[model samples]
Target: MAKHIIAVGAIYIDTILTLPHFPAEDEKLRASKYVRRRGGNCGNAFEVLQQLVEDDIKLHLISVFPNRASADYAFIRDSFKVSVDLSLSIHRDNSQVASSCYVFKSQETDSRTIVNYTELKDMQCHEFIDAVCKLSPAQDAFEGWFHFEGRTPDTLVECVKELRLIPQYSGFKISVELENPSRVGLELVAAEADAVFFSRAWAEARGFKSAVECLKQNMAATKEHALLCCTWGAAGASAVQKDGGEGIWCSVPAWKPELENQSVVDTVGAGDTFIAGMLCGHCCQTSCWSLEQKLKYATDLAGRKVYEEGFAELS
Candidate 1:
């Protein structure tokens, strides 16, 4: 049987407004066009992975959103390519889904400013624990690799601890994205995660000149069984693994899309797409392959994702 993969995080309804140029302070500007779509880190990751993996592995999503037979639910249900357990999703009568308005001012550079309208109530520690526990039946514990956004430190840590208590899940791999590594109480979460992904800026902010150095400097946080990966926009990606009681570091250059006559339309959710590719590669590829090979394949997928506007067009 193929290994099961689950991703948990927030999902948002995105409203993108394309402007001719950035507006000055107190200045009014007209938008060239606008679009609405499903977004969020895990949301995009799930969408893209569905297209890439097909039936090679089982994909599942756990998230919090407004529950109802509304547009939000309809959009997600239609876009999701796998079975979803939305019982954990909080619901409000006639509630609006969590939405974001992004102003893309690409007249100069590919940049966007987001204004978020959060509606999904933050899950409490007990609520999160209950939701995770409900995923597995009484007869058997859920057995799969879990990837989640590291947003709520207290709840996330508690969830990890509770899941580890299951005898069958003792060896389960849990990966977390360090989207905001600088946040308080995240070090504890990072130490517990089996895999940690860092943005290039996050690594440099910690006084490391490169991703490999960043991983080496934080070896204490990463246990002997853990691995770390960092993505540099055009510079490519690098990884560090704890294998055979030694630290192995590998760097791979970014795939060149420009050479292929492709222009980058937008960079939104590119990192999430890369993560999705890595997850697919991990479950589908043989373990005999080196970490370097895996990173190269993921980087190539990310490069291609940039050529399109959103993950929906990955196919």
Candidate 2:
């Protein structure tokens, strides 16, 4: 039987403008260049995962969008280079798609400032459960994996709980990313996941100084067999897995460009790319790799992503 991976989150139309520096208050500046693409935490991950996965494993996305007639919806649907199943997505009538505007400073360190606008309603727990049931009608159909972008905490927690009650989805593995620190109730979602990805900002906001410390202290909140991973930007990434009643921790240094003077060109979607790499290693790869190998693969892939503008040819 073929396998399926479903990613749940919002989709956005991203307008990126490159400039030498941010403009002063009330000052006008001309952008050096601009690019537009389909972007969102889940959208970006699906793009990279489609490139990494094998032919047999299928990819699906469960997101809420405007009506099919909207140009924004059409652009997002036609943007993917690889085939991704968007049939599971929900459409809203008379609604507009979410959008984000980014001002990227092309200088040392390459800083980015983003502003987002959205009026669409979030996906409710019932909607998520309905999509899952449609995808998995039979108990022995195929192995399934569900990855979530941690938004709408109340509905997300309920969604996971509801999924657990379904007999056909008992074998499915769940992973979630906690990237935004301001989003409350994410710990509840993390507790239900088989794997949890933590961002540097999320850790620091919770008073954890290092990635290792963040994983070690939070291990109690998760399941005994859960895998906890944290990414620390330039400090690299770390992971801790429970083994025979003990937690084993592994850390890897940040990957650098092979060619000298190859600095970071774009930082957008790097974290999402890392999530794709880890999922690829655990879900698509045939060999059983160690925790260290998984971290290294994800870290290297995220590092390579910074050298390019968009998520093309990353694999």
Candidate 3:
């Protein structure tokens, strides 16, 4: 049987505003439309994974949320059909949970933002214990893979350790993306993962000379683990194996409605969607496609996801 995916990451609710043209200083313009979607950097990845993979390839989204996060969180869990017994982590707090509002522009202009909520910084240890207790009924305690997005290294590593100590586990697989991975965290994760993915445009915006250089730096820092990948939006994606071998390259597949030509409903979750597609292929074991072929599967899904308006309401 195909192994399921156990995704660990964040989740959030996003409010998006689409505008015809961006507003200038002291200029107010009419908005084209507004949308609300289930998202969290971590949550969107799992959503994308479920849409791209098989029904048997289960997803476990390990994440944090505030006390009042039940409604939004439940919707995503039921929609994705993931086994959340072991992956969902709840943090109780008196404060309001974090949410992001994006103002998307049609032309070349900046969109203003209003909603500002604090990120989850603290989570109770007891919740982690409770989450593990729920995993007792799963078919395989570790039959799935691990995925982490924006999860703190210290906290996640502790969870990793705890899971490793469990005697009932079968096999565990993992792929991770660091929304804000520190040098130390990245080094630790890269060394332990089956595959690691990076977005070139996002990296470039943050001022890394080139994606290749960044991967090389990361690989050099990592002593173990092979299969490091870099996803270039329209350009495509590439992966580098360990032993300092030559790299493999693949073009990002074109979507049904070209993302460039199609109306970009919202771009926030596109990257997360891309990662979900890539991870799905790995988890399925049904994909005989080469590395590039596997990655294109993901890129195509991400392109389709953005054209649609929200966190892919996959049919």
Candidate 4:
């Protein structure tokens, strides 16, 4: 049998209010649209993973899904066929969860705001592993890559440590630490993973501009295998393999010749989509692929996914 992929990250409710123009400070300007998109790094991973693995693999998403309110916060749990082990991640507070508010009309141009509406409480990752351990490994239930959207919160780190202790099996047990906003960054987690993926936005945010710089810094610092990457806008992606191979760049040009009609609704989750493609390539044992190949396919899928309004919309 094949190993499974585990996606872990924060899940939240997104309140998106689009205005024809950027809102002025304290000025009431509501001339546009309003909508809600699932706004969690963990949530975004599910959108990408399910689209790629729902029909073929036994994917599991570990997150906090509070049933305190009548709202169906756990919508994806039922919508997608994957097992959503919510015991560890779901916050029990009835109060509304905090969210990221985005205002944008262009891919590179836009502003986002984060507001903490409720006291953030999440499950201890040990709690998460304990839940998974309940499932019989003899039944071949829990084993595979554990991909985390971001790294923070001591609980999750504990969870990662425990997962590493599981008896050696055919599973990869990996974690995707998408550049986290936390001060502790992925460097700590890098040494613990079989693979670490980085996107241009996250890479730049970390003050490492190019993929080469990112790779050099992380590879030197982390002993665990790491694949430093930068998702170039329209140009595609640049990736450095963990085996100390030379860095490679791939081009994923715009979908159409016309930029105005590119159908780009939002670039919010493109990075996550790209990760999905790369994960697919790795999980499926794609042979000796040029780095450009991964970039092209990842960009194509991510670019297309943005045309939809939210993190993901099935066509």
Q: Name the better of 2 and 4 by lDDT.
A: 2
Model 2 worst lDDT window (10 residues): 100-109
Pairs of residues at least 3 apart in sequence or in different chains that clash in candidate 1: none
Best by TM-score: 2
- Residue runs of model 3 more than 4 Å from their true location after superposition: 21-29, 68-87, 91-106, 109-116, 119-121, 124-130, 136-141, 167-170, 180-185, 205-209, 243-263, 311-315
Q: Name the lDDT of candidate 2.
A: 0.88
What's model 3's TM-score? Answer: 0.77
lDDT of 3 by residue, 1-315 (tens): 546565565555666666767666998877777766666766777666655565666556556665555554455455555343424566556535544445455544533443435466644445564675576455544466767663566665566556656655436655667545233465466566667777675456556666566676667654354666666555555566565454443444446573446565556677788777777666664458677777677777777775776664742
lDDT of 2 by residue, 80-198 (tens): 75569998888888785655545466553478888777777889888888898888886455676899999988899899999999888787899999999999999999999999999
**Cα-based lDDT at residue 17, candidate 3:** 69
Sliding window of 10 residues with minimal summed lDDT for model 4: 99-108
Q: How many steric clashes between backbone atoms does each model show? A: 0, 0, 7, 7
lDDT of 1 by residue, 1-315 (tens): 446677877777778877877778998888877888888888888878878775646676777666576776787667665454455554555565654545464555567776667766766666665655565555664446889787787778887777777675665689988775465676677788888888776777677787777777777777676888888889888888887565778888887765666677767787898798778777767475678888998888888888777776775
The predicted structure with the larger lDDT, 1 or 2, is 2
Clash pairs of candidate 2? Answer: none
Q: Model-by-model lDDT, in order?
A: 0.74, 0.88, 0.60, 0.60
Over 4 Å off, model 4:
72-118, 136-143, 168-170, 244-263, 285-291, 311-315
TM-score of each: 0.90, 0.96, 0.77, 0.81
lDDT value, candidate 4, whole model: 0.60
